[model samples]
Target: MPSKKIVKTSNAKKSQKQTKRDLKKRNKKITIKKDNFLKEKFLSSTANLLIKAVSIAANAAIVNREVGKRLNRRGKEALTIVSQLAVDVRNDVKQGVRAAKKIQAKKNGLKNSSKTRVRRLSA
Candidate 1:
């Protein structure tokens, strides 16, 4: 008769369970690392966007201020020109009134004598 050898299968079953637990732990670690990487990427992108938005706002403010300054300068120049024109018109109107008065006096036969004219010219 030949002797028979018996093998226990309990050890094989235990090893398979340990391998499954190891795989689960590895999966958890991978998921945690992925979450951290995603968070970092999102934060960096938002920071860059904020910086760009602030820069654009500052540029717009500068442009608006410059435009306002130019408008004010033009307005002042226009006002000066209008004031000068008004003064010239007023002087012309005064000269016309003086000429009309002189014509009316002449038509009424109120002429100055030659002696008075010579005196006026000398004065």
Candidate 2:
């Protein structure tokens, strides 16, 4: 009689488990890399947005400062003009009062002289 062959049976369940573990490990690595990339992208975008906002704010501040300076200059000019007009009006009023007083004095002197001359002629 021939000698019987001793055969070892491969364990199918154990092989399946190892393959599943390897697939899970590869998926985990891919997921970690993807998460890292997304985080980096988000950080970069946020930094860019912050930079733009700061620049815009700085520009606005400069513009506002310039506008304020212009308004200040205009306010000063308006004040000067108004003060000059007030001074001119005061001078005009003073001159008019002086002229009126001179005219009234002359008219009173002329009336008294005419009455005296008429009384002398009649006497």
Candidate 3:
């Protein structure tokens, strides 16, 4: 006798649909959280950098060549961080657009592959 595997075939598709729906909803929340995280990260970095610059200025050593070089390096690093953040956000938006288009295509149906013409308005 051969052992048979049990499978819930009908609910399999339904569960997949439910998972996609849940994923869509969860994605929105996750995006907001990501934005918040990036915002907080950038703001904190900017604040700390500002404080460091202010301290350097208060010490009246801003005129020193070494101090100027340090500030320049810090500024360049900050710019690099911000640029990378922008790239990440832009990539996320592009991914979202691609997902939206895929979903739209699925919703439009596979009538092109069907032998029979799909009736419009169910007339």
Between prediction 2 and prediction 3, the one with superior TM-score is 2
lDDT of 3 at 8: 67
Compared with the true structure, what per-residue lDDT tens digits does model 2 show for residues 5-43? 997657987798889999999999999989999999999
For candidate 3, the C-alpha RMSD (Å) to the true structure equals: 48.4
Q: In model 1, where do residues sit more than 4 Å from their true spots? A: 1-12, 108-123
Candidate 3 accuracy as TM-score: 0.39
Residue pairs with colliding backbones in model 1 are: none
Superposed model 3: Cα runs more than 4 Å off: 1-63, 110-123
- Candidate 2 TM-score over all chains jointly: 0.68
Q: Candidates 1 and 2: which is better by TM-score?
A: 2
Q: Global lDDT for candidate 3?
A: 0.87
What is the lDDT for 64 in model 3? Answer: 80
How many pairs of residues collide in model 2? 0
lDDT of 3 by residue, 31-120 (tens): 999999999999999999999999988777645867789889999999999999999999999999999999888766565534235444
Global lDDT of each model? 0.90, 0.95, 0.87
Cα lDDT tens digits, model 1, 8-54, are 67988989999999999999998998998899999999999999999
- On a 0 to 1 TM-score scale, where does candidate 1 land against the true structure? 0.62
Error of 2 at 97 (Å): 2.2
Best candidate, TM-score: 2
